[model samples]
Target: MICDQLNDGYDLVEPQAPAMLESLRAFGYNIQTAIADLIDNSISAGAKNVWLLFYWDGSESYVSIMDDGKGMTEEELVNAMRLGSRNPLDEREPNDLGRFGLGLKTASFSQCRRLTVCTKTVNQNSVTRRWDLDYVSQTREWRLLRSAALNSEDRLSCLDKVQSGTVVLWEGMDRLVGETKTDDSKTHKRFLEIIEDVENHLAMVFHRFLGRKNNLQIWINDRLVKPWDPFLTNEKATQWLPEENLYFREDKVVIQPYVLPHHSKVDQLTYEQAAGANGWNAQQGFYVYRNQRMLVAGDWLGLGLQRDEHCKLARIQVDLPNSMDSDWSIDVKKSRARPPAFLREDFKRIAKLTRGRATDIYRYRGKVIARKSSASYLFTWLKKVKHGKVFYVINPDHPLVKEALNIPIEYREVIKALLRLIEETVPVQQIWLDSAESLDKQSQPFEGEPSREMIEVMSQVYKALIKSGLSIIEARKRLTTMEPFQYFEELVNRLGE
Candidate 1:
């Protein structure tokens, strides 16, 4: 072995180009959310105005997102398109939209296999870059192609309407096209729907910035995207936090917890707006943002509460400074964020309050109409029943009794005779026993000992049955049949007890 080592030199094999496409696919994981991340980049790049243009031509449909941000130079454009080119450890400038330089290439490639970027700076001539999957597969390499030098007329033509801006065109949209009917007509309709979806998502994701005067203006197919603020503002009132809590460590972060209005207090429009603003539908929890860029919209972080209607009503806004970005476990897409263990206690406290308030509003119908006092009907019934007054003393004046006692004069007279017998006796039990004995003598059936209340209510029920066309005995039987006689007997026992 020593002799062989003396003669042999180590042969080094080059490392394979580290599965570039596979790594990108993994890094660009969330297709639905990744689109939002790209739009965030466009916004963060200081793009005042952006447009999502859709072109449909059977299997050749494409999407172009053009923005008026500061366009990159030739070298910068090359680096921007390169995968994992930006150093994650390097501190970013305040307001920079990109962290890992992977956003442009990865996000674009995640949606479409081919991506072309065109940009023009103020003084320098315009540059174009294209990344085609077919070209990559053929060469087994990731190539950044520079356009032929722009001649005087070509530069004028290229710079014509683009005035210091960047245009990102995505073609070969295989993933988006999918298996849907690729017919021109169907594709156009589908493209419109996708544009609408993009518009809606961007509006919500950038709602804060969109609300500002100089905010980002996003347009899809000539139609401007309106930023939808989830925090509903209407004539009713704004839902505000019970208190604003600020936390500090090495970085400054603010946690504002809001208690939404009771469900009944908001109209459908306002409620829907609130729900949308707070990511209320099925996802509810903390909305964490870094440098005004949303990292996670609605998540409970394994808290017991799952996203549901109750949580949707809650809105907690967490603002984190750039220093704590790594501590929060923020992903490249800026779609996921996690608070540090130390910060979680504070977040959980705020989350608990927000969730509790939302649950209260959902269950108790909000603070506005919460039970200020007990139900009136139960109180009234208790008051009347406690007194020794004849049940009819309270009944005849009551709405339910009045409605039940529509009877003929003859039947009314008979009921009056029974009441007169009760009025004559000081002990009502003796009078009731005597009335039962008299009813038995007259061949009428008496079910049990009748309390004054039972007699009065029964009289009304009997008369109502008779007026509806039964005879005296038939009406009495029908009234008893209306509800269990034992139920009335139980009521009498309860009153005595």
Candidate 2:
């Protein structure tokens, strides 16, 4: 038996230049995100320490990142300079820093036209590769150039004397320099300012790693980067949720919920740390981090359910193990992350409870003053009934009180005097009787009879007390116990005579 043979033909297509690299300069991708991508590559290269050095001449400036990592061979260095060469699905060492290979090339090209990567292995001679935008534009090709034997000395002279490491230099920053300014002095000042801004960005992006004793140390110029933790440390303020452990196959995910301190407990430093770094802005819910890297910095799937006024004070930190990356759908930029459908429900449940607690605290604060004032008045009234030493209530001056009322505490004297007048001249009974007459609008009334209008007025006065902050049940009990209505009935009989 003869088997039928099938022939498959392949067609060739012309090579095209990548638009992403060119678009970087055109679109002004020199912001924080692009800079962060550059650092991420350095960290992934097994660098235990990285230094970002900026040199600003009157009108020209360059930025360099030097790291002490496992340097690559001449062949490896060439591949490293190529764009999109690293496969995301390729298995890497457990401690490898990068999965996507586009980070270094794209990140560097986004900032400058010239990207020079120089490396030296522990026992091997150093090698260098250069990717020049001008060269690419002229040749219409992405070419990686290695140093020749004669140029090796010259190339090695430009690099630092590190035993085993790599240095990434970004030069010919025409886009960054922009059009010539008025004078060299003005241009130099602007250059310095840009460097400082870049330093701030790096400090925040690598804050967790920089702060760790075992993790890498990153420095800008000569200044050591300090980590800024979003969670404020206040002894008075803490929200600890029960520790929750969820298992997915062999992976263990820990969900620890935290309630931030009350607004009053947070100082300026604490408030800024919480509000600025932690994304504590309204509706800015949970912050999720993977491998100590912030993936989803704020909110859960944009639910918008956490927009309560008190929730502005809430922040929950969710720690996800690296194994959960597939479950989280972490993006290449690391700017957005999402939990799997199954895990989202659990997160939403925790978020709801945390936000509810914050709202309760906010509501309690709103009523605190009224409740305290009423309690003081009740205490004073009780003292009078017992015929004990007359105790005066002293109002404490507090910010909460100031926010609630515009009047000064000195007005307390005038308010007390008015209360005394009502207590002596009107009496609870007479006031009720007068209110009854006004409500009925009757001229020819029975001379000595108790009227239904008087009873209604007394009921209304009790409601007013309840509305003033007392519980309705409590106000009713107080009104009956005081016998204010009974006293008003007696006054009506006397007035008729």
* Best model per lDDT: 1
Cα lDDT, model 2, residue 157: 51
TM-score of 1: 0.66
Expressed as tens digits, the lDDT of each residue in 1-497 for candidate 1 is: 77766888656654333356645755654444656766766776678888777767655666777777777788878877777778887888777656776777778878877678777777777778777776666777656656522231232243346567777777777777754556656666867777766776677777777777887888878888787755553333444553444565657788765555655666887666656633456546777777776676677765555676776677777787777768877777777777788776666666765676577556534322333342211111211212323332322433334443446877877766664565444464554345433433432123456657666765555555455665655443333223333235334233212
List TM-scores for all candidates, in order: 0.66, 0.66
Determine which window of 10 residues in candidate 1 has minimal summed lDDT.
376-385
**Each candidate's clash count:** 2, 1
Sliding window of 10 residues with minimal summed lDDT for model 2: 376-385
Q: State the local distance difference test value for candidate 2.
A: 0.61
Per-residue lDDT over 1-497 for candidate 2, one digit per residue giving the tens place of the 0 to 100 score: 12322333444564554454586554334545666776776676777877777777533466777777778898888888777678877765544546667767767777777788888888887788888777777777766666432322343354456677887877767766755553677777777777766666666556678777978887777788776555542334655545567678776767666666776766776666556533466425776766666555557565546465567756677777766666777655666677677776666666776676667567646544434433312211211212322222312232122222435768866665665554445354443335333533524322235467765555555545555566655554444333234335443233212
